[model samples]
Target chain A: MNLEDYKGIWIFVEYTEDKISELTFELLGIGRRLADKLKVELSSVILGHNIKCDLNLLFHYGSDKIYKLDNKHLEVYRTIPFTDALEYLVNKYRPEVLILPATSIGKDLAPRLACRLETGLSADCTELDIGPDGNLIQKKPSYSENDYITILTPNHRPQMITIRSKIFTPQTPDPNRTGKIIEEHLELNESENWTKILEIIEEDQEDANIQEAEIIVSVGRGIKKPENLGLIKKLSSCINASIGASRSIVDLGWISHYHQVGLTGKTVKPKIYIACGISGAVHHIIGMKSSDFIIAINKDPEAPIFQVADIGIIGDLFEIIPILIDKLTIK
Target chain B: MKIIVCIKQVPETNNIDFNPSDLTINRSHVNGIINPFDLNAIEEAVRIKEKFDDVTISVISMGPPSFEKTLKEALTYGLDSAYLISDKLFAGSDTFSTAYILAESIKAIGDFDLILCGKHAIDGETGQVGSEIAENLKIPQATNVKKIEFHENKKIIKVESDTENGYRVLEVKLPALITVNKEINVPRIPSFKDARKALKIPIIKWDLGKLKNIDKTKIGLTGSPTKVVNIEKFQKKKDTKFISGTPNEIVNELYQILKDKHVV
Candidate 1:
């Protein structure tokens, strides 16, 4: 656990369909800050078969160094081979801190990597900082869900923290900035690996990535009946925005779990997020608090949602939605 | 196939009370229930058992002896067996230490094909223990699973991982570990027949000496790298600004406030 043994900050650069995940860039922004604070270099570990586009983008996002392990076996993400590759890098060059996006791949891969390294990892962290004593402090909401608990990895060689996407804004890429590239060879036998990616069933592209949507129209328990959701859908279509909901709505089977936005749900950072009849429980707030604009429409002005909302409306959503829809149609 | 589901007894959030003086939670007044996320994992495990008649499902938990009550509740779901790992020596364990003890206990129990866990515990919310356990056992693992399919002949397991944007379908060998999200499945309530059977069954409890290759340093607070240096009761701000207007007027006024806040 010697501090000098670990050299720099590293971000796991994840990609899909030969495209860089937005979370990769977001991690770079956060990694840059942590690296600057700790006075260490910021690096990225890119694993893919052919990631020419992704490699170029990593330099743009401020990676001081890139560790590329390009191979046919690394084409799709699986547990064993991917973990083996990452474990190799972490062992070879110990990092002072590692930041990963709390996405499905990141969540699955981060914990496995931490365990292999026999180190400490903090997951779904909303805030990360360096303590005066030079320890990595990861802060997240605790039991009550109202307050945050700041955690520090005191004895671990490389403190790992996974940040949920959309919690931090991505910084602008500087084309002028450049860094060195370090290539790592994959040594594991593909046949011996435990997991294999069978097939990639591509979902419809028309479906919006709720976490990345600029405008979102979210429904809650106040919708009353499932049929009334058409109004929300109509509004969403009119505005060309995606539809989201609180956990209550999802739990009630009013919508699929994919539409859920909250603590246990997807954390959306939409430019404009409208809450229709949502009471805004703390569990729900953790997901959408990062949204750039929040408009809460609830019958109860006392609802917790109003506290964090930029606009708080006190009236029935049924009455207001129609009028707003009519106004928008005319405009 | 023998599936081992690791569950925890957590304080129901609704019943939790805050201690202002020390900023600690008062657990005495709160009722404990199986962690909600673990319930989903247990349900999935039961579904797998039903698919394979020879499958044996065991529910395991590590906590105070009274936490064995949760094992009885698990029996109501038709679990084949239950085990409780309780010892005062394992108190105040963080994820690192907790995983070590659980892994050791799992090895002692033997005959395990798959291990299931909730993606994260509500009490700790760290989501590290399941991975830690898999690491300790040297098994492949996956988290945030939305769907699971088993290939009995090939001994391969396919899991759909719920990513932030979409899903990643992964096929892994058996004798693996998985942590499921609540979205995976709906848990069923126990029937009267199963409930009666559960009441008759006794949980097998174990102490530190019962586990093999026990690492004392990695079983408690000593093995933990992170500590809760401080915990303060959270207090919400008491400021409330009330505005009076007709529906249309209020909408207009709210719109103005939203504009000022750049929320529109």
Candidate 2:
């Protein structure tokens, strides 16, 4: 397992219903950095049915070589056939590092590939870097809601890591850039696999994915009464923002589980995130730490949320939100 | 049918504190329990076992020997058998290495129809190990499964998976891996019968030697492809500006500040 024997960094480009997940491109953004750090070629392993049109997008996202696995078996992302194709390619090329987006399919596929290869894989990594010794150092929040743990697999081969979505900014696609495309052929029959995707029923699209929202007004425990949420909602509506909440508010049943934001909750990187009376815990921080601008409105000045906020208002949210709404209407 | 549910002992996050000097967590004050998601998986296994009276559920985990506390906790939940994979040599494994060891251990146990795991470990959230185990063993896997049903005659499994937008139905065969979500089922508290039996049963403990053909290179830090090159504790900046006024006055002042900041 000499590091030198591994030559390229590979991204598992995932797609569903013929559309690529945004997480795939986000991984490319981060993968480009790792590729640059290691001074190796950055490539992508695209497995899907009729993905000829998708190959160009891989190069635009910094892949030097696109290893395309096109077959009907890969059409719906079944585990057995998809893993077999990926394992075949890995054994042939022997990539030094493999990166996958922590999407549902990627999460399921990456670890299985690592097992077959008898290598190591790091899951849901928030941060990744190369050590001086050339080991891929992965930093993830550990202890099931505690502080961050830095893990290094000094002895592993073809280091594997799955990164969460929105943690890395996607690099702008450069249409002018060009790369080599190498298509791999699968040797297995589709009928032999044990799993088959019978149907894919699409859900109604919600407008409230926190990562895409420009403005977010989040409620915490400090709102006092659950009825007080109307005031916060009115304020959010006035600003054309979505409403979010810390885990405490959700646990208290003030809001639905979908509104909760934290490590176990949804990770939001909104441009403007307003915290109402939420005492910032590390679990909550990991979810919203990437926000472009953070505003904390808590009566306690010493609350941890204030530490990460660009603007700190040491006042009760109940008293402040209505006034803020009124003032916005004036303009 | 036999099912294996893998669980991990994790520090309860609600009470964790950071020691500033070393950037490590202060675990002394924290309580440990089975990871919440893993608990959901264990509960699902129990439900499936109950449906098929002949089924047996085995709970397995890989951590420090002290993590046996979590296996006992699983017993209280009605798991029929328990095993702990612990060795000083297995330290510092990334998800890849973790899956490698777990897959090897599963192989040693033999003849399991289904494997269950949490969608992602709360601490790492990498969600890579379960799928990796399926890959290592070359089995089918469905993740973020909210609902799972087995069709006995056809040997097909109907799984409802959580997608970015909604749910999708997938059909996989037995000897597969399924990672469940918290929405699947409410885990039951252990009955007195199971609780007492759990206390009486001894959990099987294994070291690296029990696994067959384990390439040491792929079992620990050596087999891992990733490493943490460096760590810098997140530093929080102090805010100097504090607005103090009567409640009404403070509201007005906040209004003005919001206007100035264009946050309204």
* Top candidate by TM-score: 1
Model 2 C-alpha RMSD vs. true structure (Å) is 3.1
Tell me the spans in candidate 1 whose CA falls farther than 4 Å from its real position.
Answer: A191-193, A205-208, B13-30, B152-154, B232-243, B255-264
In model 1, what lDDT does residue B256 have? 58
Top lDDT: which candidate number? 1
Residue A39 of model 1: what lDDT? Answer: 91
How far off is residue B107 in model 2, in Å? 3.1
lDDT of 1 by residue, B1-264 (tens): 889999999878644444433334556767889999999999999899888878889999999999988899998998888999999888878777888889999999997889999998876676788888888888878788879988867378888877654677888777888999987899998889989988888899999778747878766666776665654434343233444467666656655564565444
Top of the candidates by DockQ: 2
**How does the DockQ of candidate 2 come out?**
0.50
Docking class of 1: acceptable
Shift of residue A143 alpha carbon in model 1, Å: 4.7
